[model samples]
Target chain A: MEGRERKTLVLGVIGADVHAVGNRILDYAFTQAGFKVVNIGVMASQEEFIQAAIETSAAAILVSSLYGHGEMDCRGMREKCQEAGIGDILLYVGGNLVVGKQDFGPVEKLFRKMGFDRVYPPGTMPEEPIADLRRDLGLA
Target chain B: MELSVKQMDPEEFGRQRQEVLTAWPTGKEVDFDEAVAYQKELPAAKVMAAKLAQGKAKGVTYAQPRAGVALISEHIELLRYLQDEGGADLLPTTIDSYTRQNRYKEAQGGIEESRSIGRSMLNGFPAVNHGVMACRRVVESVGVPVQVRHGTPDARLLAEVTLAGGFTDFEGGSISYNIPYAKDVPVENTIKYWQYVDRLVGLYEENGVRINREPFGPLTGTLVPPSISHAVGVIEAVLAVAQGVKSLSLGYGQCGNLIQDVAALHTLPLLAQEYLKKLGYPEVMITTVFHQWMGGFPQDEAKAYGVISWGAVAAALGKATKVIVKTPHEALGIPTKEANAAGLRTTKQVLNMLRDQTLPQTEELTLEEKMILRETRLILDKVLELGEGDMAVGSVRAFQAGVIDVPFAPSRFNVGKILPARDTTGAVRILDFGCLPFDREIRDFHQERIARRGRDEGRDPSFQMVIDDIYAIGKGMLVGRPRG
Candidate 1:
């Protein structure tokens, strides 16, 4: 494939969360990493993510939530994508996914149940994922 | 080719029953300047002068030198960097000593330090909101425009704080459980504050001081619909009181949640379209966070949130006048200088790139893209209205009552809710209602038309339409002049 034609990634913060600093950084880093990234930014709803993915023919939808209520805010995001007919589109979520102190084991289970393809803990950096992505997509 | 001209059409005769409204440059600003003077003198000047004199006598300075140095130095560096690199500078304002131990004070100080550090990283940028008197002191001592902020018991105190800060440019108190409700600085305080500000302008007129008003507080963070609406209303009200007030500053405070809402993003554009039409492209400041609950997320998650989409929206679409960027380490407690700097650096990098990139806009929008934006805006508006209604009854109560505890809103539109609907019988039930707007329909039509035109031109649809319609619509409206 030519260098000009690379798959795009649609990324954002879910629900009513307004944390933006991390989102900005990821947009820059991803661009540097050579991914055509379409960043929807914070407080983006599931529909916004799905639609952006469709419009861009994106390879994945990366959802970042920092307010502990991610579990609450991000619940069913995966299912919504599937219903939108992009069920094959990969969904990745990270950050503190639940409010206060919640059990990680159960939270992971809950997210998996909700439909996320992959889930990371509060501090999962983007570099590792991009590396994994390269390997998974045979880019490496 | 000669242009076809409709020459000598018959001129309509006599008895014309039409009223023609022509642009009458009433030199309104001149009259406004005088009114500004009168209002400033009446109450604003006296109250501010007395309060500022008192604060100066009391003299609040940086409390912890080590911590203060760390914080202040970060600010200085950030300001210097941005100035040197981006050529984007800010008002000069720095804190002396800040509160120790208390979470709220410490939080406020930390935000200030980060802000200052970022400011310093830029060249030719000055600090703002140093303190009421402190700001004045800096302006007097340094001979640069200084930012001054005040928090008082009431509207009268707001006036006093403004005066004490040696500023006609000022922001209101914290938007938390206490300060905004304090009997002295009640929600009605803007009324009082502006009344006094009006009088102060009058005083300035007599004395010949060129000062404008800068109003800031978290209108978006209110978890209520009218929070921002009310904040705008108050600004307009104050402007009415002080006719010559040149500028106004308003923003959401610590509102990571609101920024996350697709609906809230649209509000800035609407505000720019409406209230700020006359300002000729005023910078609208907005605040967004990265960490969980504004902090406490792991580094990777935090970085993603900070750098990826969240930051992109804030800079590209939000068209923020000034953004108060939060660090990931906030949840862990006060950020070390390194951590704070890293966050600022990341933000700076995003801003730099966005400037170079093409973003989405509505006017030159694709049908699908425009549909998404309009639907998102509509959903968010409805949700915010509900949230606002709940806020009117008290947001804290609403939160407790579970009205806004979860993100789910009932499905009433076909585009559907951003939050997920319940899953029953292994089938995910989605809420769908509402028709698309005319603007969105028009956009979609043009997108299809462009695609067809591309086919005729032997070019790819996406190729010919390289320009981002959604961004053009969003940011264009945000920074564009409105049609009469």
Candidate 2:
């Protein structure tokens, strides 16, 4: 356990958001926290995520959307992943996922319905997702 | 990539307009004849060029705030608040991201979602998706002129819809919009796209409509030097005028140094006029806008107010026609309407107090102006030389050769070789000149400035200093000094 292989996670800003800063920060944080992070960078479509997940055999797919169109962008992503033969892979999303300030409860529930295992609001620190990933993946 | 700087032929433009109008449902609502009629009836006060000219003639600096919400009603209400309660002299309709990327369908969805939720789901007004009628309502709701401020590389359709909808001013240039806002968009494509936009403005002018065109002055808004942004602004202005755009507004983002900021503003209009006249477009009306510090802002509302006030003072003393106001919640995410109004109020108060006080013609100010002029001339001259007297061709080649480079841009087309850092006085100076066509004297000046700052800080001039300066303001400091 002391020298166990790190869990691989695919991370990116989904849809057309080219928010490089947050993506870079997350890449650094996950690497520092001993996870294998394959940051696909920004403006990634759902197909790109599936391809990367298959290529890296990633344990989780962390999709980030900052430009408030996450609901539309994330819709059907789970079904797409299942069709791509990676249905069991973990899915997480965070950021200013929606435009306007809707209650986080409903937002989280909506993402869960879309098959995301975890949802984070804007300004969510990297550690929160990392800790949750450890428990969910039994890496703890 | 074979871009033309010539005025678009009427027949060609008309054919293109047909395709452009059919891009989205809202586009279909823009009837050129009706739009022209609507624009003719708009009062002089709602005409941006008229307001800017009035401000310039009277030596007054007008205040404008960036604000837009999803719903048309809410957006109009927000702008009204900025105009009435905040005392904003001009208003803006910031288009949402989806619309900026020409994804009108998603923007339409955002508008409907915002309406159902009773909150703005989109970050900005989807003016294109809302079409000519909704935009006209927005323009009519506010007493002041409303400018279309969005970062769209291919804004041809947007320009057509917005100008037809009664927006008197349009912001963004090919270089500014592409280098700063896009990752893989080619410079030539955006330039060609913007030519269509400018040609549309020209057509409106021919039909007796006077629309103001502005090239976003702050390229990356990091530590952009005066010369780089100036060259881009002048180039865009020349391009616009070539397409028959009559009224042009060139802008400069505030650097913290008082003398440098003042000098940048002072020389922008003068240089633009000289270049425009030299380029055989002497009749073009030019105006200058000073954007209140476009970089990182302090999270503390009070400190942010201080920064905003200093920007206002610069704009006033520099005699810029207008200043884009920044809110106190800049360090946070998108600001609330109240915060936006607060910022405009702060800027208006400062502008009023310093209206009569002129920036003194001190030796430092003169030297700064001279230095900026010299650097700007060198870059622009090389660009012209590269184009072989054709700016459209030269701009693409200039960027390809890295003769004109924007620091910290993510665009694959951008060279991203230049590195900028603050001088001893917190004036942004080039640390690495990249491949900019500057002579040895200009290089020596920037080297000496950085060396002096490094000597005082007991460290060498390096990328670390540039990194520190990037995060300095957010950390409550102008120059990011190393912690003791």
Candidate 3:
């Protein structure tokens, strides 16, 4: 994990959601923006993300969920990571994080309450998060 | 011409007479020649000779059509234009708008338009054109040679009957083209459906013709068990045609409703390319569209799908022979006539500009794109290593359920291992916006999914799709159902 100025990020779509178009775009965009992204593809689980993060010694974990079931599925994932001994790693999630119509304030609060460091609505460009990660890790 | 010249030699005659006698015990040789002669107003002997010659001609000539695109009736004009303008390079790109809803009147318009323009290589007729007359008109009309799709009952029966009657080039099968609507097929039924395709392929080959199976439907959802099985079955049937199946209608993008992860979408195109190639299919028509199943984001978000531009990248990298563009306007409904025209125009424009891109120059990537590319390569490798005795590809669902298992997982990388980044600055740059609110409605939208699955339905659907839920909630749209 050394000598590489670029940070390693674990990215994927979680659970039964098999959406790949956006995931691929994110992969391209992140790589274009100078991040090493390990895209786990579709139908991923919390364990998969944790394992990749741990294995890659990733700078952060970025989860994308397009299916409306993200809230139900992504809940407690941060705790799960803490149990896996990588609690301090940054957690960034975007895309449809819940099912049905709801408010963003409570939604972002909920993800934060669940321990996500940063949350984005669907269509959040990767550049914004990468820039934040750069500043947070003091790479900038 | 003497009667003796038309007649068989005595020994041959005796052999035929005795064989006929034994085959039908007590059957008398009724003077059928007299009846035929009366009908034709010819001598009995001449009539016999003519009947004998007609029977002889029954099984003599046989030729098969080559692999190419099957245009839907609606896209015929645009296809013809693509052809006439020396766009032969685009022939493998299939036309999709001509669904089962339209009639022959619409079909004729495409047919006539193609004829008027003098480019007949574009293949496809209406899904409902099931009779011999319609088939014959289509086959002969766009005579530069093309494959046809038949979905109506008459089309299936006509394809069967006509091929039996010596029109060997006709294609048949309803289930193959209707792949998108079949997500919930019982795994068993799916298996049977594919087995049936083998029989259909054999029938055509018996008539001395080969068929290019249309295994993917663009607007349809995932390529589930049935379609996957048919794809493999088509390969086995290639032997009937005295050659291996060399072309496949794979990578037809559907709504991607079953696809919640990049793994699934990556699976379709990669599998379509490598598996088909491994199974000996040489040509593949890959469709990369931003259809509804891609988790419809608001237009702005959807545009970032990068599928349109990157799809070209993947197709080129995957070595796809053809790529079909889903008109950006398709998520609304059947594209308007203007939209359809614009779609074709965009496809042409993009393909023209990308004709010489020759990207993926270095299949090997720096650490930046390494993990993603490696994950994709590993998946493709696992898909290819599948052997005859192994569980079939159609059983991907079961495969995921641990009914069977592939050797690798998506996260199989070393920890603390940072992959190197390459090509830091590319012309096509992605501009990122800092974190923003979910626009109250989008958040409330996601809450409903939680309430329904979490509180109401008692189903603990994962929250991995928060983005989709938030987006759908904000838009006040739930694709499959109305949220309670």
lDDT of each: 0.39, 0.87, 0.40
Say which docking band candidate 2 falls in.
acceptable
lDDT of 1: 0.39
| Candidate 2 vs 3: which has more lDDT | 2
| Candidate 1 Cα misplacement greater than 4 A, ranges | A1-140, B1-88, B91-134, B137-145, B149-168, B173-186, B197-217, B220-244, B252-309, B362-484
Residues B88-160, candidate 3: write the lDDT tens digits: 2222222212222223444445445555754322233332323333333333333233434332211322233
> Largest lDDT belongs to which candidate?
2
Q: What TM value does the first chain of each candidate achieve?
A: 0.90, 0.97, 0.92
Error of 1 at B82 (Å): 9.5
Query: TM-score, each model?
Result: 0.36, 0.90, 0.37
lDDT of 1 by residue, B417-443 (tens): 112111111111112212212245544
**Candidate 1 TM-score, true structure as reference:** 0.36
Candidate 3: segments with Cα more than 4 A from true spot: A1-140, B1-129, B143-180, B202-208, B217-244, B252-319, B361-484
Model 3 docking tier (incorrect/acceptable/medium/high): incorrect
